[model samples]
Target chain A: MNRHTDTPAGTELLDLPMPEPRTCPFGPAPVYDRLRAEAPVTRVACPTGLTAWLVSRYADVRDVLGDAERFSSRPGQVVHLMAHADPERPIGEGEFTRMDGPEYQRFRRHMGPEISSPRRLAKLRPLVRAVVDERIGALAAAGPPADLYQDFAIPVTTASIGGLVGVPYADRDLFHTAASGVFSDVTDQVQLAAAVRPLQGYLFELVRRRRVEPEDDALSRMVARAPSAEPPFSDVELVAMSAVMLVAGFDSTATALAHGVLALLNDPGQWARLRDDPSLVPGTVEEMVRLFGGGAGIVREATVDTEIGGRPVAKGDYVILAIQSANHDPEAFPDPGRLDVARDTEGHLGFGHGTHQCFGQQTARLELTVALEALVRRVPSLRLAAPLADVPFKTGTSVVGPERVPVTWDEILPAEGEGP
Target chain B: MRVRADTALCVSTGSCALTAPEVFDLGEDDGVVVVLVESPPDEQRETVGRAVRACPAGVLSLAP
Candidate 1:
């Protein structure tokens, strides 16, 4: 099926076969590396059974992500079932993920103030530090053989998002269960709708309470900020957004952090350089963003027949921007696979490139930087508690992480001033 | 030369502050942006440059 008709602009629309997904010893999937090295941009069959272009070139991905109008995010980004899913009842537009133009901007603006500043994020530093410290404490208490992913990273990230989204500390378990259930494909429409009902119901109550008694929290602020309209969330939006915040804030950062630490650990020299200079943490974080390769791709469905990467994509086709592959594109970064903590990763599309670039990035950065720095400093002698091969690497469908990163240290007792 | 933020346009994402904390600070409540000094330490020029590049909303500039 390599034959293709010429576009009106006279560009050739060559049919490119989708490369098989990449898996290698060095971590990143092979499809990405192969695309970056060989094809960059090619056509692929999406999970939704639609054939569309997958842009892997760094410049191309950034260009698409930046031009939000051309590559609309509203086009059923999530799996159709997931997007149409109703936790209570299969419903209409759920939240910002699938929204565009006015409505997207409206809700985005309402929530912007909370996540826009270092100051806003700084407020959560103490809480994040506490979570980090607690995780470290648990890891230490459990002894050398501990899965860092479970014992440390996941919990810290979940707790941090829980705190930020105004999930009462006591009800975090409920939030976690519901969040996980919502993402997992346990059922068609019924299970998700049922799971979401309780979670959204709680958020509704929380929003109502916040409206009457505004707290110094994001939920309260967003409640006050969202324009008074016909459906001022109707308790539904509040709950939905709250759950969205938890999933968005928690999983993305958590996965990034886990993979980042794993990358550093695998590379001794990079780890040493970062540990030696705490000042390098910022650069290190960007490199991690480049390497973590968070979302595989941002999926967008076509509104009208259009040409992408010189290929004719008919209306209703889904376009997937291979973000992870693009980040590794050699044209974008010199020696892309080399874990240079000092690499200028300014344009890396890890947290995404443009307007829809993660709203919680600042928060993610704070969590990762602080957590990584503390781990490096405190666990100076930290090493993998189990063989890399034996470790259950987090993989397959959706988010990727180490199911458990078991680590060990030969009891390098804490510094005199450092408290346990 | 150093980068500074025009607080009026600043969205307060702290991309600059995170990139070069030595050269940028944010107000506690209102989220107003602040440059560290009329001129930052020379050693921080590259960091400041990165800060200028990191500002997503394009509110930061370099002063020669």
Candidate 2:
């Protein structure tokens, strides 16, 4: 399982850290800027103590993430921190993210429609809105000086995803705890395995139940669609797919929502603009997605010798797409540092690019839009309770977000219809 | 303007629908890009162009 042992002889590995920690919440590591200008694709040391090429420019990052044939998503191909300590597993087995070629397509085809179909997402909008309203209501009733991350963001995201996945309301805490551990930055192989086992077992049992008596939810739909596949999906495959979706959907969206709120509060002008025009919520959410740091951990491996940003990449070479750097690239985004709610953030790599792009992006957008809109409209005077520098930020993880966003607001505005 | 989508290459990221909903919609059954307006009006040409550029899969294109 030691991927570094497979490193070709005579290749010089740079001692740069993977996902260089941010000194500022809004900006990427300063080294990323230098890399984009100097070496868009250059070797860097991974947290696993291995080396991989980091692609920094927007176009080059897209090139690497977009070409599936030339670049493979197979698990063993990438340099994960825990890979050496864990046993070698099959490439296309656990999750579609780890699979390439037909195997990846098969699973994605079955799961994609359930999550991305416009008709289905349209139906889920109200459910998502309701989740937002309920969470905001709880926040409003509980009074000021609350942890928005815990009080609102986590609940709204977890409930929305949980409902879609058919996890019962009462089981959300259990689901959240187990799913969070799986996505956390725990480097110990045994600890990582311990975190993943509970989730795998939970999903297996859930899928088993759905198979017997299907419910009106995403997992049930997946269970019903399983038999229609060419060879039919096995229980193990179903569980793996479900686990991946849960971890991917919950962790990323929750992180984005929390960070989005923090960004708005930090820039009062943007918050005021959003509150003044609720119609701008969707656009603001898009801008927030562009500005945030969600895709810092995306990795791909070259299956064939290729050139990116004019740098040669050998087969089996691991490449990390510096998504935040790409998103902030001045050529792609004007005034890349400023939070402009009106900017046309058309091609930002927040959800990433190419075949492996996020399937749940539309749903994630809907959740962020609804949640942010509801929060602003309900509490017009909401502001951060603590200094921005004092806020705890989660680091050393694929996803970056505030661990706690303590905020307070002037009087809780009376519920609509209970007007003055 | 004539618009077409390479369904084979589409990954259903929905960037087209997000950018130009009038011209493209995600297929209900397969989750691939569905071209709603093959020949879009002149007014929609700009939006279609944006959608084409926004597509992560590079599946959509306009007639030259």
Candidate 3:
């Protein structure tokens, strides 16, 4: 009994794969351009063998992601790759990501201040900068032809996020190993369970520890603040919150950093421009995010029969908001295919929209800015060691990035003030 | 242009601040949008407009 055949009457189904593998690393599957041109909101066969309404246009995608009332983020309600395979439990259970209305608001209210506060994130900048510098220093010592994705982006992102979340440096590898699988393309029930179990156990223990002896990190602050909320969070809920934060923090930023490097490396002129002017780092980061930010798309379930881009959507129908397509929509952005660091990326859906917009976006931006500035300043001659087409890209993952960005440079520049 | 933010609707994604740092910021206590410039000079109007449009939550609006 294939779920694809179970679509309600009056809905049209088109055979289109979700998370459509990219032929070009910088853009989404070419099919999205066709969809945006013709059927902006049409039923399509998801990769999981279920049928979902794939929303492609910029305005339509925003409308779906933004209207939590009309569209629900609850697990089974919004079917994605993994959720389609396993609908018994909510994805990111107890995490605000799956919650709606007051329940979501409650959890977000408690967790928001700890991670998203400008003051808290501002204080993290120097520490983040130090991490970037230390990582770059190691890369310099290792010489050129290093995988920036693995050696540089992964470590800096994991360490900075781990530090904030109170994940012990000793347990960092174990934490990352377990957390990384949570976003993998794996959809088998047993395989998914196996991937998530260790992470769940680790976070449960960490939450218990934070409860007893709190630290200055985000986890401790969340624990301390949880009890004061209108409807206090349970231990299990807090554990889930930590798990969500850890995965979200590490995976998205790591991908962005790695992909940002790949984007810059692809355009030597842009790379040179950035190297010449460090002030462009912030705008460059935004541009990279707009151009290269990857996710299958935002998923939402129709809570009530609604109209998306003037197309009727029935209640309980799954809607996949193709964010990458929307970000690259020619309507919203002129010459959307081109990467312009100086382009005003205002209103890009990279961080998403509405109440569900990424709360930690500022933190991600800060990390990217500091890291890119440091890389260009330290190694202005850095270029891809391998041909761009030869580089492997990660598939079957919610967020996409280079498997390894093998980059090389001419001469290793000495640390500032060090004798030659 | 007079700029006002509907604090009730603000999600504090900080897009406005990132778009126009001189005109907007997030509150220290609640992390909601804070309007730093009520009336912007001509020089800052375009950036402020971008900031208003960049706001995901539709909290920012301009009045003549």
Provide the lDDT at A80 for model 2: 50
Candidate achieving higher DockQ, 1 or 2? 2
lDDT of 2 at A367: 87
Global CA lDDT of candidate 1, please? 0.67
Expressed as tens digits, the lDDT of each residue in A1-420 for candidate 1 is 122221334333434333222334333566567665655556555433344566777777777766655666765444522433322222355567666555555445445557766567778898888878777877777777666677777789888887787776677666666666655533455665666677777888888899899988888877775555334544566666667787667766777777677777777788888878878887798888887664546776566777766656666555678776777778888787778888888778887755576767888888998888788788877777666666565443356566666677776445325664
The candidate, 2 or 3, that scores higher on DockQ is: 2
Ranking by DockQ: 2, 3, 1
**Residue A88, model 1: Cα distance from true site in angstroms:** 20
Against the true two-chain complex, what DockQ does each candidate achieve?
A: 0.25, 0.57, 0.43
Better of 2 and 3 by TM-score: 2
CA lDDT of B42 in candidate 1? 85
Q: Is 1 or 3 the stronger prediction by TM-score?
A: 3
Q: What's the C-alpha lDDT at position A8 in model 2? A: 44
Q: Write the per-residue lDDT of candidate 3 for residues A1-420, one digit (tens) a residue.
A: 243346657666887544433466888778888889988988888666666788888999888777888988774422466532543365554757777766676666566566665567778888788888788779878877899888999889888888888886577766566555666656565665676778788888888888899888888888877786667778888887777777778768988988888888989999888888888889999898888664567677778877898887777677888888999999999999788878888778888787787767877888888888888888888899988888888876777778888899887565556555
RMSD of each: 5.1, 2.8, 2.9
True lDDT of residue A382, candidate 2:
91
The collision pairs in model 2 are none
Tell me the whole-model lDDT of each prediction, alpha carbons only: 0.67, 0.75, 0.77
